[model samples]
Target: MLAALILLSVGIIEIQAGGTPICPTITTPDWGEVSCSNENNVGSRCNLSCQAYFDLVGTTGDAIETSCGFDGMWSTATEFECVPIKCFPEQVSPENGEVICSANNFAQSVCVFFCKEHFDMVGLSAANNAHAICKDDGDGDEIGQWVSSDGSTDFQHPFPPQCQPIRCPTTMEAPLNGQVICSNRDYSGSYCVLFCRDGFKFANRKEKIVFSSCSKEDGHDSVGEWSMPDAPSCRQCTRAEEVQLVALIHESEGDRGQYQVATSMIAKVLTILRRRHGINPTLRVNRYSSSVDASNEVFTTAFTLKSSKREIDAIPYPGKGANTTTALRYMDQRLTGDRSAKIAFIFTNELRDFDAEMEMKARNLVEREVSLFVFTLPQKNRARTWIREQLVKITRDDTRVYALPRMRFTNKYKDEVAAKINDITMTKGCDFLI
Candidate 1:
């Protein structure tokens, strides 16, 4: 939109940037047209006006003044050229978006930016719905730059913004005794659904399923995240049934002081369950260790709930490492079908040989309809932390992991533990009965 002027010489010789006066040839700046008025003589004037979209090379004002004198030479002279106005020409539009610009990219043009669906414009450039005005970077070269302008954008093509996938909070975790599935391809309009396993239900009015979707937050133009506050949880089916308790009590030289409590808890769990499962001669108890150095490694004979106390009492101390993979594999061979409600309890200080293989076996045990509970003696270390992580993978349900407040159990806790196990085998709790 801007225009400029240049003063030419009126004389026998045509005016040019560097050429000296010649008899017949004329030279003029390529930036614009030069006017020669009818005669070539002293005092006549030659005029120059820059081409469209080009500004005068140097000096301001409507015109720069100079004249042709009787000496037949240029009176005043300087070197310069006309340049096209623009912001950065190499600019790329935001990904997954398009833009419209005004003025054919010449001076004073503005540009507007728009992103495709499932994407949100990000960065400060999105402040005004993303508009940019053609301008210079504030240096004299005027190579061109787009600057954020008076208000929100729609004005195109300079200082373009970026389009990014929208998002919801990634903080939501799978609930206890249940699983969560989410489809968050671009987070825009994405959703998450929760599923409770068989024999388990949500405590919130006994809901079987729960879910929520992600949406753009009001007043926000970019990626955002939302989370379920105090997230819902899954509780076990409260029903009374026969419980077959299969426990693996780990024994090691340094027991973390769990040898006594682990054994006592098992004996109590069996007693609490004696009324329903003690009579089943097919169900038995045993002590197993993957380490050859461990005592009583083999599980054998008819040891019912009544007779298993002696077996429980004899649990070896300073025995050795507990390889749970072997224990789960051992149980997998014996339990099947719907004859009774089966429960597997594993007691340990910290895990040993508990790897992906062990987790897979534990999951297989759970899928076969067996309730698996892991009792770990509370302590600290990288091993303990690792055990905590692996336990979630094995159980899928963190509720199944029980961390003791102390190395030893009190009579009150022992009874409470027994009662918790007993309660799991009953069917009346979902009805809200005590």
Candidate 2:
């Protein structure tokens, strides 16, 4: 009887458990159906009994539930999405500043409000998502500036205007022969004149008065005319009365003395006589060299005159000391008798006792009527004053004694000496005999 009662009670308890609610169930269309009996539950199941036993004994509520799809899955209908951040360009610090972004960067569509030329960016480029900013240093014309994209700076002023130098025009007119020159900076017009040779007059004198102003009619572009008649023909003296010139050159070995001056004087005298009367006088240039021996080279060198019609000769006298004395004696004899033969003596260095010999000769042969001119060259180490005194004593009170300083013998002083000779000859006339 006890076994029968135990089995029956067990059977009754099992049948009641099948029909009783052990836990709440969840159902879904995709997951089919699920029971929370603890036999096939996905996770901790929700049931009224479990809830009441934990702490909700008096709570009149449905079973507590837990999710069962996936470990981190949530309903897509209830999920909210996160939005992406965006960046934009800000205003440029300097509005006048220009900007030059990279071509690729620009095409990517980034705002460039703060971008500028020769400036640095303060914000993001197209490659980044940050607000962009730009700062312009300034253009080249500014006090402190930078270069542009082309590596050039703004000019403070336009490039200075280029200018060309002025050039004077070249002339081709004859006589003027392009010798015309501009006088000043006023070269815009014709400003040149023509000149003619001395003694020859210009046909265009009125028009060519100054080189600074020339006209086309004045032969500035063509050969001009001569104002004066053809140059006077150089004539030769045929009569003795026209004029007369005689040169006595005394040369010695190792002593050039004033031979050049004597020759020059003779030339001047002849030129003057010719110009005055349009008559070239008969010239007699005689050279007397002391070293006139068979072996002396100077004996063969004859004195020459520029004129082909004039007579020029060199008389060589032998014996150094005696030749000079003999030449002077011959000159005195010739001049004393022949009134036509004008004479002048150029003495070289005074040899031993030569001065005494000359003084004696002067006293004996030289008369007051004979015009004799003497030029004495001072000897080195010899006083010029003493020589001048000696010359005065020999020539007496005559103006024939001319003592020229040695410095006058140089080539540089040749012109001055020639001028002096001309003055002397012009005033005295060729009739003075010297």
Candidate 3:
């Protein structure tokens, strides 16, 4: 026990003399040497010296000596890194190419090359290796440099890598009121499409490609060429030339049963005119019953009827034959100074009165160049014949009278109705003509 106590006391005294933990392990760096005064314990001093072509960094006290302190730390910063001397070759780049590098010297440092606009790199496996790295000579005695080619022995390859300009198919400028967007500005296989601004519509391409492509050449062609259909024009109609359509919807009690049909027909006509053709026309709806008189304008600049119910609800149906002649007179007054062709679509189930005065009014319509078309849903076969006769008497044209069959409001019937209206409007309306 006395001997053990003596040994422990000696150890304590040795630790107190140092008063710090054991110094960290030290070793000579590659291409360099280290010298020590007292070794790795506390109060030990270490100094670094590099071989011929290397330089030391992070050193102190004449930039070399570093001593372990009582706090178990080096007097200078740890990791006294030694770096190789820098050597740069005549920096060169390929024609039309630029170079970038992380470092100008030392092994593992790399230089990258890139081609200018309209050009692409060639001769190397770009998918795998597109840059050059600094490496050492086989004997580790000579400094190496980045070169253009793997087999080159010079500092840089005598002939640099090539960059070839890319050529694409030719393209025309964008059309009026339209924009063209391309995948590649002028390159083979580039694609482009046309877009027109609001209020203008692309015309004449009902069943043809509107987008263009820089297509690969056929065997007959010398080079790849642009492939495109005849481009369509963005079409817009002038305000004065717009067609004027006035639908005089009959709201007499007798025609109330056909309200759904009339509503559907009017809505479909307006939709085709405004939505499909982009024609904004003045629309005056004459909802007349001799008892309750209402003239509701459904559309002037825009059409707002979304459904058949909305339109029917907007028409007040509490009158008796407010007189089709009266409605025509109203439209005639509206068309006083306007020289544009007008269409007066009259929707009715029966005609209350057909007199000499009505005939004169009808003749006035023809004189004013106002086209009249009559769409009727008569009650009986005899009544249908009479209504047709009356339409001919009023408009003086048998073709202008269309006696609709008594049927439910089905899609097939609606489609047939829409087709009939479309045919008439396209053929008769001046704005629909080319």
The model with the greatest TM-score is 1
Off by over 4 Å in 2: 1-246, 255-258, 276-283, 287-319, 322-325, 336-341, 351-357, 363-368, 378-386, 405-434
Q: What local lDDT score does residue 424 receive in model 2, on the 0 to 100 scale?
A: 36
**Candidate 1: residue 301 Cα off by (Å):** 41
- Per-model TM against the reference: 0.39, 0.30, 0.38
Tell me which of candidates 1 and 2 scores higher on lDDT. Answer: 1
Runs of candidate 3 exceeding 4 Å displacement: 1-240, 251-255, 291-299, 307-312, 378-385, 407-434
Q: Where does model 1 exceed 4 Å of error?
A: 1-47, 51-53, 57-83, 96-99, 103-105, 115-120, 136-142, 150-160, 185-188, 204-207, 218-223, 227-230, 235-434
Write the residue-wise lDDT of candidate 2 on 1-434 in tens digits.
11111124323211122233111123332212223434322333423222111222223332233432222211112111111111123222334233333321221222233322222222222112222222222221111222222223442321111112222344323353223334432222344444443222334232223343322222112222222212222111122232233344553444444444555555544454445434453334455545323232121112234532133323343335524455456555444333343434445445333467777776664452333555655465554334555655555545556554464543444344334334433323322312
Residues 340-388, candidate 3: write the lDDT tens digits: 5466777777676767887889889877767777777535334432345
- CA shift of 99, model 2, Å: 99
For model 1, how big is the CA root-mean-square deviation?
A: 13.2
Better of 2 and 3 by lDDT: 3
Model 1 C-alpha lDDT per residue in residues 1-434, reported as the tens digit of each score = 22222345642444333432322213556666555452334564655555654555664432344445545553455234667667666345678887778864656677777777667786535756666667644344535565665543344533457787767655446678888777863276666787666667777555567876666654445655544523477777655434466667664456435666676666555554555433222344455566322345324334444456666666555355567788788777666546456667777666757787888898888778777777776453434533577887776777777776363553445555555555555533343422
lDDT of each: 0.59, 0.35, 0.58
